[model samples]
Target: MYQVIPPCMELRDHVSHFWFASWTAQQDRVQPVYYQTASCLAELAFAFRSSELVFASVQGHSPHAARYNAGGFLSIFGVSVFAYSLPLLFDVPPAALSGRFCTPEQLLGREGALLVEQVAGEADLPARVRCLNDFLKLRLRKAAEGDHRIIAAARQVMKPEVKFDLSAFAGECCLSPKQFERRFSACTGFSPKLFDRVSRFEYLLNNHRRFTTLTQAALASGYYDQSHFIRDFKQFAGCSPQRFFALSGY
Candidate 1:
């Protein structure tokens, strides 16, 4: 079973949501390989049964291939971290975390190491949730004045019908082209082009039910045509679109 909750109003700018899942060990529990593409966000995930807390960062800073992994059993609680909000969550910089997973203890020092044991000892999911929220709320800070505009521009590029023009958009933001590119990369971990590509792939992967056919899904996700869609699918998913959809458990 699983549950998901949006971050509180104060955290809406930095966090996407808080989610938890529980599983029972069984001889026949279904285990499947998952082909995951990159994202513009990072996540802190905890697997209580195994006493594991990991920071997952598949932020597509480069055009890398897909990441493959398998899942088994556990009780897990996770918070999705936004690209620009990394500093507010941790003293670490966002650029350092691209395309890798780090244990919280490795990233946060002794305080982080203690969090694993502390949050895991909570009596129930609600207790766990409160524990996590209290910890994060203490670290909150006001977003930088420029961050508001940068993040707003980034959001415009991810719209279903994206109409992005590098020079024009930069001018609109009152920044020179190079200045815009630099700030955009600093705010999001990737160049604007790579982020748009991976984000489109992420959108269709997560929102498969929004369309009934490949063409509909491709076009709605801002792809120019089927051929380009297939190319990115193979690049990020490590398989043809057909097999990606044909898998028994995703």
Candidate 2:
């Protein structure tokens, strides 16, 4: 089974969640599913900070193919970039990125695709992820810091029963409205408003379960009203909050 190291406080800024798993050749199996890749002796990593689709491919075969099944995973989440790798997209209408689903052999930077396994048994997954995350953090720190800053700002801006304004947000980012929109898209692969909306929805879904009332869930998640919440929920999750709650069985 895949096991994930818990997040260190500093690294948690960009990582929504992290987990790792290893299986014998016979045990490492995958179900046909959308947005999920497979592995053997594999490590899976992801980052969901801003809307930007930053992810990595340290080792492993592509989910779309069955060669060099040794196992490792590094993928980004966002709108399809259409590179040789599978371009998983996250946006207004989030969809898995698509591509030839290339393997480690095709990597431009050899270490980039081979490091996941080299460190697997190193006695510290969380520390390793956090250390590596430092690199990603520095990248964000240098590359406008807009990605991390925006997500952090959005979290603060969200409130129950209140709708966030995009124009005001643009002003706060110190960019003209038009410039903000362009920069937001370039960094996150989606507009600021849309990214915030989806993020709120994801937060709600993660917290909801069998006993969580629809009204309570909506309220806590920043829905202005039940109807408003339902509209957004259906659009993002492909089901109403009620249905999702029932299916959750939590």
Candidate 3:
């Protein structure tokens, strides 16, 4: 079974959703692997009663097709944290955890480790949700304030319809270009310029149905030329636009 719910109202800005999923061993064997795609969002997942030391993950954007193979019976509860929310939620920078995961106990030491145990013992899904929410809310209190300037910069990148000039936007935020680049990269795992490229590619991918033709899609995505568009998509999706769309059944 699979289920998803929104975070409590207080955590909505930083958190995208909370999810739960489970499958039997036979089901796992039937559909054993899944591929990941380029994404700006970070995710945190917890495994329940699994053989893998109750796996905990806090991961960042993936640039390619990372694969995961299913094993045994599985149940997982997780949250999707917005990319900019890294600064609002964790002591670690977004770049620090990009493309990889670390144990909760390792990341937060004793408190995180204890919470993992408590979650395992919690009676029902609602109780477990509360346990996780309380932990996050408490940590949010201790976390440093998120840089609204950088958040705004990310927003501009996210909205490709707006004309964006990296240096000009930095000036608007009262940050030097270099300072803006550093802080944006630290929070988003991509510099403003690169994030812009990814955002355009993301638009192409998400709206693949309308972009049925390669030339039209590339131009519509704001790329200067078809070659540049294909190059960026290859890097982000691990495949050319044509190949990716065909395989994805677009």
Q: What is the C-alpha lDDT of each candidate?
A: 0.72, 0.44, 0.75
Q: Residues 1-250, candidate 3, lDDT per residue (tens digit)?
A: 7888889998887787888887666633466554566777777777765533356666676555566774543788878777777767767777777787777776678987887787777777788788888888988888887787788778778765766687898898899999989888887888788778777877777565685576886677778887898788888877776677676554
Model 3 ranges off by over 4 Å: 1-3, 27-31, 49-54, 202-230, 240-250
Q: Is candidate 2 or candidate 3 better by TM-score?
A: 3
For residues 1-250, what per-residue lDDT tens digits would candidate 1 score against the true structure?
7788888887887787888866666567567343555576677777655555333222323345565544643666878777667766776666778776777777778867777777767777778778777777777754233466777888877776877788887887899999988988887777878777877887787676777887888888888998999998888777888887786234
lDDT by residue (21-105, candidate 2, tens digit) is 3333334465322222211112234322232223444332122212233333332211112111111111211122221232332
The per-residue C-alpha lDDT of model 3 at residue 212 equals: 54
Off by over 4 Å in 2: 1-6, 20-108, 119-162, 209-212, 245-250
Error of 2 at 92 (Å): 20
Which model scores highest in TM-score?
1
- Tell me which of candidates 1 and 2 scores higher on lDDT: 1
TM-score of 2: 0.55
Name the 10 consecutive residues with the lowest summed lDDT in model 2.
Answer: 84-93
Per-prediction TM-score to the true structure, in the order listed:
0.83, 0.55, 0.78
